[model samples]
Target: MPAADWRMARFAPHRTAVSSAQVETVVARAVGIFGLVFAAQTVPVALEQSEALAVGAGTTLMALLYGGVVALAVASIGKVAVTGTAAAFAVLYAAALAAWPLLVDDPAALGGPPWLYYLANVATSAAAIAFPLAASVAYTVLVPAWYGVLRATAPGGQADTLLATLDALYAMILGFVVLIIITMLRQASRAVDGAQDAALRRYDVAARQHANEIERVRIDALVHDSVLTTLLSAAAAETPEEQRLAARMARDAVRRLDEAGASGPRTVESVGLTVLVRRIRAALTTFAAPFTVRVVNAAGVELTVEAIEAVYSATVQAMVNSLQHADEAGRTTRRELRVRGVGTGGVVVEVADNGRGFALQDVPNERLGLRVSIEERMAGAGGTAVVTSWPGEGTTVTIAWPAGVDGATT
Candidate 1:
């Protein structure tokens, strides 16, 4: 069987029980009404045959049974597990009906036609279907068969047989109608459940997206608080060196802010890598004095919006590091920032500074500018940023991000 069918089958017993209970409650009320009617008919017959022992005894028994069944059905309202009780009541009702004929002088003269008794029999038999499988089969088939045998020996045997056939047909039609109604109700319930499930899933997705956006905003706020404010304060420092350092830090923080503001590539379409590269190079020159930018094979490179933002941010960080730490203002003419397209697969952005470079090993562990902003950001964007620097030699910061052969970033 298919997986869904198997699952539904496993759940069917519980669903059946619930549905059966509902059916039983409705059927019970109907049966109670029928029982009341039957008991009432017995009243006049008992009055007319006041001295007949069999008639009086049968009338009393039927009245008591009908009253009891009515009480039981009323008490079991909204309860589905009363199938067995309902079945017992059905048996009692059938037994009472059979004995009722014997109570009157002429059973056919009691009320209506003899066919009415058959109609009542058919209605009672149809009520049996509300019970669980075993009880329903026993009451529906066996009780009717028992009645058939008893009726066969009666004086108006042909009439009883005809009534029985009509009742049987009525029972079948009633069963079919009940089945169709129940089926339609079940289908409607399932459709409502499916719609609710879909609505919940959509809510979950929206919640997750909102949480991500909030986190991004938080990160941006933290960057502004720690980096941007400090740089702005440093920019107003008395000494030129402190002012330059502050300016560089402020510029770094600003670039980070811009990148953060640009919703990740996941939220947008592709952007040209060449244009992003040129923009980064220009920003670096604007932020730091006398910075030389060289572009080699930077044409025809396109990347996802997020990847582009990541690459741009990393390039800006490299430039900021060169401007702040690289002591090349008095020694070298300018700092070199090279942008290159690596083969047909990726783009490599190299920021090399001829300054008093610090050893990579000597860099402090808590420095988040390189670790968090550069390396972590690149990694999240499915790329890597490498920083290679040693004392007395030039520092080279290279950021590599995936690029399609036709210059598209996935």
Candidate 2:
């Protein structure tokens, strides 16, 4: 198939696609709404059973803890604090359950089930959303069992064994249902995210290949039409005017050819370190963001022109990447460029940024700025590039020529 036709092929839109991060966010909001609704339902029961609770201390503590849960739920709905909110709900609900027996004025006066019983499902649901599978499952079983034990004891109105068992089972079942739903949604969303990332990586490789092919075709056409025409005109010239025209066309063709070869591979030739540094300094001025430059002991050092160009290009690409991505919220980022001579013949260039960084492995394979432009370019020129970064800490890109030498000055 023709490269142009393949490149033109349409890709289907992902109308129904969703990522794990997005699914998690939606689930968190839904759980928040669920908690709020359950809170409302528990209110009427609390009022009906107010006589059962010890007036001042018990009621005040309940209000304080439950109010905190309600605030967390509201924050979740607004997408402010999700993970922390889920955790707080689970912990606070457990505290309330443990304090239930002590808070009651008289267990015998509690003729019916406690109002807290109605919110058992709410507590377990919060646990399911907040904790890991093992912890959530344990909480589901333990909390219900504890409730059942309380029901069969004097402090919990001394209910029959069968009644307590039934109550525990019901709450456990509801908790399990919520756990299953959330687990399945997260698993499916992760699968979708993985598939989308793979697809994008494949597309990136194909697009790069297509661009190379197009450039090759353009260079081939230039050689054939312009170069061939100039040669033919020079051979056919008979008069001084014709000769001058042929000469002018020949010079124009040579200039065009030189432009074409500008991006091609070059033979190794020695160049002074000062020349490379000067070129980089000139390029740095073009960037809008400023970089702190440091140079040390690089006066007399010499390296192959191919290596010099590779290091220069890689350094520029690194600086460009920092400018594009190294941003931290609520803080200013510090960027630096360092160049120094190592050993007698080696050179090193480094670009560092104290900005919001990212895990190297997490970067998509198709991101040519690192994989192709910097790393691959350096490798092709017989040099090495190492990228080090951590999320939030910062990023540093170190480039070294002649492969294995490092004489980096602090």
Candidate 3:
């Protein structure tokens, strides 16, 4: 498309259709283009009513209205940056407007009927606002003053001083109306743009905060699953076999802590669900209590790094809780870790043991092992952890990430 059409097109006002920046630019362009079109009306008026263009140099005088119209028409390409073209046009227009009267009959003779007054003011209305606000204000006022002086001083128009002054004032008011409306719109657009930028900054801060919280939950669960679990297992050990298992737990805890401290946080990465569960089941063999692992339709399941880590840590913590707390002194500890698909694109994991169990409400908050390591950790990752236990029946801890939840394992 032509530059002029492109500039005018910028003013299309559909807010949903265009960006905020474009919406404001289009509004500004509309105002400028309207002023230019309003001024063009004077071209025909000059042709029908003015004798100044029929005098010795009248044809050239006639060309001022025509040239000014052309300049304003080109200037309506408002959206594009056209600094050089506009500057050249402004210079040529001023020179042409100023020379119009010099070529008229008896240039120094007393003014009569204020020749070309409306035509000149209309052209000024179109171009004068390209200046700074203060300059435009001065011109909007001065153009009328020039018209008043020219007409009021004319011997033939001397008796119509009041009419000449009113005419000048009328033209000035019309020009300022355009300036005022556009000024308000530009200020409003800037305010809206500023608000949009602020909202985006807040959103970024929130996203970062959410990520940090998830990281904290994962680390807390890891400590419960590894370091704390090892200490408790060492405390519960009676047989030499149990003692050896405790020693291994200590070694694993030491290595975990050493590696964690030596290296900064590792980036979260995807893990296969079946592979993760199998690893956990293999690790459980070292414990005094035996655990049976079952995978039901959970093969080939994939989950996000954070989801997998959170679930893995919490599940391990649950199994540790059972080994350390569930078994009675003279009873066989039979434990099961089951992972199964429970809903549409969802999974349910349970750590169950047949041993002495306590009431869920009786468990104190001081036990961060269950609250933070499992429940709170799951919640942070948009999942749930439920601990159900009675005085006699075994404790069952279920962790689930339901279908349609954000960041769910798929």
- Highest lDDT scorer: 2
The per-candidate count of clashes, in order, stands at: 5, 0, 2
Writing each residue's lDDT as its tens digit, candidate 3 over 1-410 gives 45475345334331221223444445435534653565565555444434543364555655644554455555445433322333334444445445544544442343344345545444444444356667667766766666666556432245377887787787778778866764666567556655543543453354345545655666677798998999899999999999999999999888987765444333232334544464466567777767787776654455544565567788889988998889798878788988875433456788998789999888898999999999878776667788878987889888876433433332
Candidate 2, residue 42: Cα displacement in angstroms equals 0.9
| lDDT value for model 3 | 0.61
Candidate 3: residue pairs that collide? 11-26, 53-58
Q: List the global CA lDDT of all models.
A: 0.58, 0.78, 0.61
Rank the models by TM-score, top first. Answer: 2, 3, 1
lDDT at 384 for candidate 2? 91
User: Please, what are the lDDT tens digits per residue for candidate 2 over residues 260-284?
Assistant: 7666533333545755676688788
Q: C-alpha displacement of 230 in model 1, angstroms? A: 9.4
Segments of candidate 2 deviating more than 4 angstroms: 1-16, 108-111, 234-410
Could you tell me how far off, in angstroms, the CA of residue 305 lies in candidate 1 after the best superposition?
36
Candidate 1's TM-score reads: 0.35
RMSD of 3: 27.4
Whichever of 1 and 2 has more lDDT, that candidate is 2
Q: How many steric clashes does model 3 contain?
A: 2
